[model samples]
Target chain A: MNIYNKVYFVLLFITLISYLGGFGKKPRYVRMVILLMILWFFTSAVAIYLVKYGGLTNNLFVFHISTPLEYVILSMLFRDVIVNKAIKRIILLSVPFFVALSVLFSVFIQPVDTNNSNIIIIESVILVFISLFFLREILLLQQVTVLHRFPMFWICVGILFYYTGNLVIEGMLNYMIRQSMELARRTYRFGYIFKYLLFILFIIGAFCSKSPRLLTKKEQ
Target chain B: MIISVTVVLLILLFFIVSFLFIYKNRQVRHRAEMESVKEKYNQEILKTQLEIREQTMKNISEEIHDNVGQVLSLVVLSLSAIELNDTTKAAAKIESTTKLVEKVVSDLRNLSKTLDADNVANVGLVAIIKFELELLEKTGVYRTLFRLSGTEKKLNGSKEIVLYRIIQESLNNIIKHAKATMIKISLDFSDTQLQVEITDDGKGFDAGDSGEKNMHRSGAGIKNMKKRANLIGGSLAVKSVPSMGTTVSMIIPFSPAG
Candidate 1:
């Protein structure tokens, strides 16, 4: 819609390509983790664009897909953590809590005291659940040995770096607290730039690691 | 109205792109994984084939060294014992060459006898091994010994050939390189395993360095033995300490039908 948004979208698209390119002979689960992260960023950007620019996108299904998608991705990435009976029960209990939280945040919670209270109330329900799922996914990843294994460790590092880039775009959406508007804008630029750098790092790390030899998976 | 139509179109396009990317990427990755696994399997099959070929060669060598070699010595002895006058001394010289020709004949026989497919089904394993050792013992150079413990039973021909080849190769190693006097061969059937041990008091080489030092490619012997063992679903090990002695053990799982 604007020059700044155009630049942001371009940066985001580049990051998406880099993420797609990470799929060398990496195992299925590891590849899934990266894919989910990319989806999160991509969809988040789309959601932000929809909210800022008036689009006739009024259907509930448009944004509702994110919640279910996030839930599935989070479950897969942290199956080890969520697989436990107690933990699954807890997650099940958290579903309603997330629904409530999303509604509350989208409406009552102030991001620099927003002017449009009605719009906030509606989107907050979806945002709360998606954020919860994403956070749990990250937490589950912590339990998985992805960070410790040879090739995966590097991939994991790259993901973390790429996620840092998302923070830049996220900080600008004004959905969350921002100490300074100018600082938020600057952080957005820094984060996007950092994300691009991480994408490059992922390639370098993938090539250098001996995972292909160890797993005997050929990278095509 | 235009804006609403655009938004709906964008949402549908989003699903199409997501499905296309996920499906295309999955296809490529799956193909790659399958190819890698296929490559590894091929290498293993090739290695197994090489081992089988080597073992076949060793069996031929043993038949030559034990059976043919003995027959050649007898021919030489008979030639040496013949009385020849000066006039026939030249003929005696000609007679000696006959033994040399017999050597070639016997070498050919060695090749044929070892590869004999009927050895598996005909005669059985015990008789074949007994026959091989009896031939070697007739040499009188080394008193070769055979001792068996545990229940006696007929084994699958492939298993027999493998065990026989292993025994044949270890003895060949002792006969060719290990300059030892007494060679003891024993078979023990215990713990669902058929264990064959051969010990020689020959000028034993250090086994720690045997693998590294014996770079002199006499591998037609040891290589064949290992390959035969592998084919028979067994493992072979050789232990040699310098100057003391050398021991070769072959373990073939027999019970529960290994």
Candidate 2:
């Protein structure tokens, strides 16, 4: 693994540790995020091992399988946090539709062997929209007096930054690769910075979480 | 290419920083707004408490003058007429005077118990309101009816006081202006809310005169009633029609404490 991959794994490790420290206290949606992070850690490890040691030239197919799963997990997280009933129902209904679209794009258009830029771009767009929508809702709510202390607010911010960066980087990946593989590799390495940012924000979110029991009592 | 990539990253960072700044700014503004609301609510509560005290004192003054004073004056006349030589007659006079004295004591006791601000919490809102209606009935000028439905629930003491004052203000308006012979007050308690309706049969004014101009022309009683209701997270509505009388309705949500 390169130095960037090593550093990425370290950040992921720190995020997981932070999440574990607050595992019992964190709300259900936050626990789901911990699960997502764990799944991501394992999938990333496996994908890297396949590329470096399993005699595989490319591990883009791993992402093809993981992308829809990641979307489902993140969508579920949003569904829980968002208060609007109709928006919640739409988010619920869109999950299967999103998965089907991802499958179709993988099988017919992009193919699993190539970098799944199309799926990543679509995923990025949908997630960025949802994140922005969540931020808007939180702003309107005005319930949380201290927004920084709110775990979901930080998570939403993290999602916004990560997905927005992903949208731009992945949108250019295929074109960059076709023009010059060296340039694509350089650009892809830059995308790791957002991953680092996502993990750091996740750590902050984990630490910011108040125990659900305490929250319930405070509300009462 | 490197500079373009740097610019994109810089823009992204700037967007995030701006969002944080905006969010923090909005949060500060929200906190300030909430503090102002709380301050206004506290002031209203203080004002309501003072109003209740003032109303209680006024009721006591009126009772002493109209009822107790008249009864005591009659007792004084009865005692002064008793003669030593007419023993049997004097005994009868003494017996009636003793009875009158007992009644005066009872009336004073009841008045003290009901009119004291502290007893509002002790007697509960319904009993206090029922007592008020009973006093109106005793006047003989107006027939007052108090009907209560649903299970009675106790609320926070301050909230109860504010509610009582709102009801008192409504009744005061009726007594001063309604010229209605019959007054009806109904309290309906549901799981979620307590609804109070006060209806009077008298010469009513134009309900449509409730515009801003009319509100200023009429008086501050209705506006004050509405403000008191809102202070306790409740609502007040006044409906009046010329020759059809006026009805004041107030609804208060049951708090978790209730």
Candidate 3:
């Protein structure tokens, strides 16, 4: 196993730790994000293993299934943070639209055997936009003092980091794969670093106190 | 080309993250500043409340001593001098003593009403101010007049209490320092505001000169009154000329209930 796989395994352990540590009890949104993350880790890990050893070469299938699910869950989580009823409704409405587009593109517009560049590009761009929007919304929320302590803030940061990195590398993914499989795999390893950064942020958010003034109270 | 693009995108992302971090820092700092201001405002309010309570206690102590104690002492003297066998003289002394006792009871009742903080709100500001003027008039120290104009309108409860205390502080000052022969308090209620003017024809000093030079002298009291006016969202303006008169005016805004 490479360093990327090692980090992935660590992430799995972290997820289990978060659950056992009861990070999922109080805040409904955090619990949903954690569960979605756990699901993504397991599903992706299984897909990678099958492609490598079990001779299942259709690696893009996993993404076709999981990427849209990730977007929907993250959007649902953001809905909890958003104060405006109208903006929240737009986010909710976008979920079904994105899910259908993902399905149709993976099935018809883009072939599943090759790198799903078109779907990946669309997902990366949409996720980046949503993440940035969330960050702006969090900024406008005056009640929040310490941004890092806020679970939604960390979640937005993680998404923004991951997708921003993913957008760059994945944009050239198909071309890179056609040139050299080894080069493409190496570039993906770099992307995995961003994935690691995202999970680390998730871990921090999970352990963060639920109360806004928890740190201030501790200081007092 | 792809590697170069990737590096550039990564750098752009880094910059975006940095910007967000900076924005978050600014927000946290702003929130901290707001919290501190709110805390200071709360502390001032608490201090004002404590001072009002202290002043009330002091007034109550003086009332019990100067008025009630003196009258009761006279009652004691009159009863002691009574000859038991002299029925006619004894009856006359007894009647005078009864009148003195009745005066003591009435004074005690008025003092009790002043002591009850709720009574200030319950009796209404107009009636309370009238009673205060009556007390001053009874003392025969100052010729006091209370005039009410326009329809009386009730205000926010706390605002009323604070306004009353401000008036009380002004009265205390007039008695102690102004050496006024005549005091007039006028309550004018308009559509949106209530104006209370407490004017005294006394040995008045320059209002501006005193506020600045004597902030340490009698300025603390003035500061206290101003702080209270700000607390109740009212404006307190003091105008005085040496030997002409002094007027302490408070304009309090009230929203009518539909």
Candidate 4:
């Protein structure tokens, strides 16, 4: 394995261990995030095995099937955390619609033999909007006093960072490949940085306890 | 291509770091705002406590000069006039003196009960308010009426004190400026809220008038009452029409945990 894959596996392993350690202690959202991480680990391992050892040239179909499932889980996570009724309704409605679009794009546009760049770009955009909306709502409500200690806030930051990076990189991936294959591979390696950030932040969020109120002078 | 991708990644990192920086700044601002609000609330509570104490002292002074002092003077006069020679006259004088002394003792006891502003919690809000109305009735100036509907629920001690002070301030306002003959106070209790209405059949001023003269007349007292109400998470509304009397309505939410 190359240095990139080695680091990727190491981060994935650590995140999985951290999540499993907190599985019974954390909230439902944390458990949902653990499930998403497990799905990623499973698909990634299977795809790597088939490509490296099973003699299959393309294992992009595994991600094609997993992408919509991941989106559904993420939408559920957003729906669970967002308090605004209108935004929640929009998330609730978008799940089925996005799933349909992903299926159609996979069947006709990307064909599951190539990287699902278009579908990823779309998913990343939607998630970026949701995460921004969640952050704005958190800012307006001022419910959590210590933002750093708030689990949902950190989870939101992770989502915003990952999806934003994903959106930009995936939007340009196809064009980059047409210009130069080596450059495309190098650019694609940068996507792993975002993935590492997502899981590392997720681990931080999974371990976070409920934030305590700021202490007054008497309390101190 | 590599250069472009690297620039894009750099820009994305900058965007995230800026977001975190902005969010942290807002968090600090929010914390400072909350502390200031809490400080203001504490100051108001202390001020309200002082005002209640001052008002109680004034009431005690008035009761002594008007009721207890006069009655005691009469008792002394009756005792001094009693003759040891005539049994019938002496008995009559003694009897009247006894009655007068009894009344002084009763009035003193009632005044003492109201002396401690903090006793509102132990005596209960309804009883304290009723005692206040009874004291007003004793003046024989303004006819006072009190009505209560629904089951009485106890609130937090500090909140009860604040509510009582607001009501006392309202009554004081009516006495000082309303020039009204009758006052009605009603408390309506629901499952989640308490509604209080104080009405006076007085020569009321125009509430809509924001002129300097009108503001000078009743501005500070009304503003203080409203502020006290708000500090306790309640709302107060004063509705008055010239010559049509005035009504002060207040609504406070009830928290069972408190």
Cα-based lDDT for every prediction: 0.56, 0.84, 0.77, 0.84
Task: For model 3 chain B, give the 10-residue run with minimal summed lDDT.
Answer: B209-218
With a 3 Å backbone cut-off (N, CA, C), the pairs that clash in candidate 2 are none
Judged by DockQ cut-offs, the docking class of candidate 4 is: acceptable
**Candidate with better DockQ, 3 vs 4:** 4
**After superposition, which runs of candidate 1 have C-alpha atoms over 4 Å from their true positions?**
A1-220, B1-118, B152-155, B208-220, B254-257
Task: DockQ for every model, please.
Answer: 0.02, 0.43, 0.10, 0.28
Model 3: per-residue Cα lDDT over B9-91, one tens digit each: 67656865785677768776766886897687667656656766787688678888999999999999999999989999999
lDDT for each residue of candidate 2 in B1-258, tens digit (9 for 90 to 100)? 467557756876787678778877886786688678778877877888788888888888888898789889989999999997999999999999999998899889867965664457888989888888888898899998889999998878878988988888888988898899999999999999999999999898885654555455557888888888887889888877889998888899997864
Per-residue lDDT of candidate 1, residues B1-258 (tens digit): 345335534553463356335544654665677688668645654554455457667666766777677767777776776666664875776677686767769677646654553354465555556655655675677777778898666666546655665676677788888888888888887767888888998888755555634423445666666666776678877777778878888888874444
**lDDT of model 3 at position B30:** 65
CA shift at A74, candidate 4, in angstroms?
A: 2.5
TM-score each candidate: 0.34, 0.86, 0.54, 0.83
Off by over 4 Å in 3: A1-7, A14-30, A49-56, A80-90, A104-108, A111-123, A133-155, A174-189, A203-220, B1-28, B43-100, B118-258
- Tens-place lDDT digits, model 2, residues A56-138: 99888999999999999999999998988998998899899989999999999989998888888988998998998999987
Complex DockQ, candidate 2? 0.43
Better of 1 and 3 by lDDT: 3
Best by TM-score: 2
Candidate 2 CA-lDDT value: 0.84
The candidate scoring highest on DockQ is 2
Each candidate's iRMS in angstroms?
A: 13.7, 3.9, 5.3, 4.5
Q: Fraction of native contacts in model 4?
A: 0.23
